[model samples]
Target: MKRKKILFFIYTMGKGGAARTLLNVMNNLDRNKFEPMLVTLNHDGEYEQYVNEDVQFIKLEAKRLRSGILPLAKIIRKEKVDIVFSTIPNYNMVAILAKMLSFTRAKVVVREADHVGGSLLGNLKCLVYGRFYNRTDQVISLSEGVKQNLVEKYKLKPNAIEVVYNPLDIENIKQQIEIGELSKEVAPIFNQNEKVIVTAGRLVKQKDHDTLIKAFAETNEQVKSQLVILGEGPLEEELKSLAQKLNVEDRVHFIGFQDNPYIFFHEADLFVLTSIHEGFSHVIAEALASGTPVVSTNCKSGPSEVLANGEYGDLCPVGDPKSISEAMTETLTLPPEALQMRVSKGEERAQFFNANKIVSRYGQVILNTFKK
Candidate 1:
């Protein structure tokens, strides 16, 4: 019997949530039922090793977004794919056009991982694309907050948009834990239990690393915990200068682009995320899975939802450094058992985003959609 084909469409195979989520779907999809393939706009980025070797990977050179969809649709037909899943914004716009052109009865799944609120330009763009988004067979958001945002801002039918949390490779991470401390095969950050405060995400305005720098600087220097920012991007210089201006230049370290980020979580005294807003913060789950304590800004949507309204980790007002610092200081003073409880809480919540479970949801969505 011929097998069904599934294609994951992505902007890039970069080390971001969208790419990682695409890999999660590819890795965990039942092989007996579906054959997985990856279609990426660009091939450059992290986490390439995580993609299953059985799956075919094809990269279409970047071009004018509209022009590229026609070619991408050609690949879909050539691959005989039954479904095309796109996770980036422009890719969604392209996915609709491509599938329409293919005329091959392929289902198009558009997943939005970016925070919809807190960005005027983003919300406006979503409005313009509101009517066209209906062309997608299904629209997936990472959090309920995003789901609501889409419904309210774009007047999308709530039923049409599904909230599928980002999948974390929990069992894989646990297996790597057994391998050794060097999970990523990358060198460790070389700091011993030096009260590390760590955050990992692209250095973008939404991540608000500059706010984290200010907050860390305000924390009592007597604690003297090191501030480490993982991941790299456009805001590196501005964030570094903020660290300097806050007089925490020597204290804050910008460790750009660590492929294996969990090691820092394991080694750190506290894991922190200062994102101004997020659709969902998958790194929080990773930190918990690594048995690390966490703290984050009470950013719209993800952090509070992931932290169970502060049950899993301490929450500070977004962009408020002193409040964040105070929360971190208080977290540092908690009893060791309390920290353990927090870690356990985070680990407990991590189950909701386990790789197999999330992948299963995708499988169900795909099969159900096709059945329709």
Candidate 2:
């Protein structure tokens, strides 16, 4: 059998969840059956170190997507790539356009990384995706929620989409936790007997950190606890201001991004996600793998799916501070045996997203596309 030359294209090798998921997929692909290559619009990103040495890495040297389309097309034609797999909306569109312009017979598979019902701009982009996505061979959704949104909102054919949960390297995360060192600034936050609540993600509107702060403040005042947010973004100051206004600033610790967040997850009494939306939260799975029980807003997707409707963790209404606060307090106050049972269930659920299984699902998708 001829080894299929699969080209995984992305805008960059950034540290975003989608980028990390793709890197894991590429690294775990069966090299014996498929020849994997990576193409980045720009060569620079924090995740550059994670790329496997065996995979052929190409940089278009173009700073933007518009400038890289021609270069992308040229590479597709020159390499005669068998499959062009791209993630996120912009790169997916670029991959389809490049393949069309280059007139390559390669299968173009695009992955949707977020829920589509967020803003006006997002809805408009959904329309554009609906129009152009038909040209691609397959559409991979990070969750069934995202897949249904594409089909119902965009009127896409259901058969064209596949739900492949993001891959998590549980072993790799565990290893990192073993070798991971805690930051000096965040070290003291966990030292006390107070319940420690942690959340990890970029500080942005999408993450809804404001809601998290408000909810943390609403938690039982007598219940001593600390809220540690492990990420940095444009809204850092805004979130800090919200924490101050709520009078929980002293208890809210904004420990900026850490390379190894698994350590914090391992130590946390509870992990929470107050995001307004998500396709599939890698952090939720990571937290679960670290044996931390979670509390997440029942966003458009992901949390409910990963938690299996509250079997593994608790879910609250999206953007509702009261609901989130109640869930957090309930989770925190649970009997020690009850919390441990939930944590054990979460650990079992996390294995469903093991890198090997998810990568094999991706491999099967690529192979099926090639067969067609």
Candidate 3:
């Protein structure tokens, strides 16, 4: 039997969630059963290093997305792809276009990665999503929370959307180490014998790096540790100013966009996420895989779900610096032996989101879509 040709599409490989998820899926999918291909709306950004040897990538020159319809149609027709999977927002529009123009019987699968802002236009998107999304045969969401949003806001048929938690490369996390002590090349911008707290994602309003700055500033003098944030974005200067204003600038280091965040995950003393909202926080899984103790905000959707309602990591109320400070201070005091025990728990829990399991779920969804 011939292998199914599946094309994974994304807007751009910008350093955040969707791009990383697609990159990991492409890297780990079974080559014998599926011929994976990729389409990037813009050729720019990282994660290209992880694209599989067998998978092909096309850099569509869509200066304005209006230009993409003709070109995207050409690629779908050329590849004769069986399925086109789109991630996040605008790219879904692009995938729908390709599906409309393709000569091949290509199905479209769109994944929703965020919950809040989406609901605003979600009703609007769902109208299109309902009219056309069902045309793809299936839609995948990163969390049950997001799936509920899709169903509630869009009145989507329950059967139309499947919740597949985003995958983390646990083997890579295990092999590489959570707070990587092995390689300085990808190390989180600072050398610290002190207790280390790490967070990864863009520095922005939603990520709430400012809350982390205030929390770290309040860490009692007796506790020895540093806070590190990974990823670069529009809020860089503002976050730096907030750190300086909070007087924790020395202790709060923003290491702009890292290609090798896994090393930081491996070696860190504790992992923390301060996001205001998320489809799912990928770093939390990375931290769990790294075996580092994790502290996070009880953000609306992803963190609470990923933590299994707080069994996997410590949860503090969102935007509360005092609570976050106390949590970090407590985690900082844990003995290495006890810390290892916590890390062991994380390793077991992280298996739920392991890369292969999630990718297989993705493949299965695409196949099931065609069955109907």
Candidate 4:
């Protein structure tokens, strides 16, 4: 049997959720049955070290999307790639166009990474999807909500879209958490006996760190807890200003980005996500796997599904600081035994997205696509 060549394409290799999820899938692909290769707009990224040495890596030197079309097409034809699995709307559009320009027989599978109609860029992508998305061989969505948006809002055939959740490397996360140690910069913050609450993501509007700060401020002053936000973004100064305005700056610690965030999740009394929207949250799964109870907004697509409608964690209304504050306080105030039960439930739920299982699903999709 001839092994299929699977090419994973993305805009960057940066420390974003989409990039990390792609790396997880690429690293776990069945090497015996498939040849995995990576193509990035630029070769540089924090995740470059995580790529499996067995896989071939290509960098299109183009700084902009328009310049990469011809290069992408050329590589597709030259490699005789069996399938081009692309993520993010911009790259997905380019992938389909490249497949057409190259006239390659390889199937182009585009994965949608976020909720449609969630933002201006998202709405614009919906417009593009209506026009060029069906031209691709398959469309993969990270959550059922995302798939429904593609079918209902974008008017794509429901049968043509597949829902594949992000794969979480549970064992790897556990191992990393075990070996990871807190940085000296954050040591003073965690040294105290106060209860700790944590959230990790890029500090952007999408993350809604302002709401998180407000919610933290609303919590009882007697609760003696600290909020630690991991990851960095453009909203750093604004979030800090908001924290100061709310008089919680001393308790709300912005620790920037960390390569291994599982340790913080493991050590925290609670993990929360205040995102306004999400396709699927890998951090939620990571936190659950670390046995940390979570409190997240009932965002568009992911939190409700990942939390199983509040079975595994607390879910509050999006952007409601008061509800978030109450949920956080409730979780933090739960008895030790009750909290352990929630943590155990979370651990069981986390297994559903284990890397082995999710990767096998992708393998089946690849095989079925070729058979067709």
Cα lDDT of all candidates, in order?
0.80, 0.89, 0.79, 0.89
TM-score of each: 0.93, 0.96, 0.92, 0.97
Q: After superposition, which runs of candidate 1 have C-alpha atoms over 4 Å from their true positions?
A: 117-121, 178-193
Flag regions of model 2 displaced more than 4 Å.
118-121
After TM-score superposition, what is the CA distance of residue 328 in candidate 2 from its true location, in Å? 1.1
Which lDDT tens digits does candidate 3 get at residues 152-243? 76677887789888888877766655444634543444464567778888877998888888888887465866777888889999888887
Candidate 2, residue 23: Cα displacement in angstroms equals 0.8
Q: Per-residue lDDT for 228 in model 1?
A: 74
Clashes (N, CA, C under 3 Å) per candidate: 0, 0, 14, 1
Candidate order, lDDT descending: 2, 4, 1, 3
Instruction: Give the higher-TM-score candidate: 1 or 3.
Output: 1
Residue 113 deviation, candidate 1, in Å?
1.6
| lDDT, candidate 1, 1-372, per-residue tens | 356798887777787777777877898888988899987765576777778899998878764566679889899888888888887677788888898889888888888776664468866888866677787788888888878878887668999988888888988777666664643322344444457788899999889887788778877475777777788899888888888787888777777776677767777778889988888888888888888888898887888888888888888898998888888888877798887787788889888788888888877877777665
> Per-residue lDDT tens digits of candidate 4, residues 7-77?
88888889799889999999998888899999888647988888889989999989788788899999999
**Candidate 3 TM-score to native:** 0.92
**Consecutive 10-residue window with the lowest summed lDDT within model 2:** 116-125
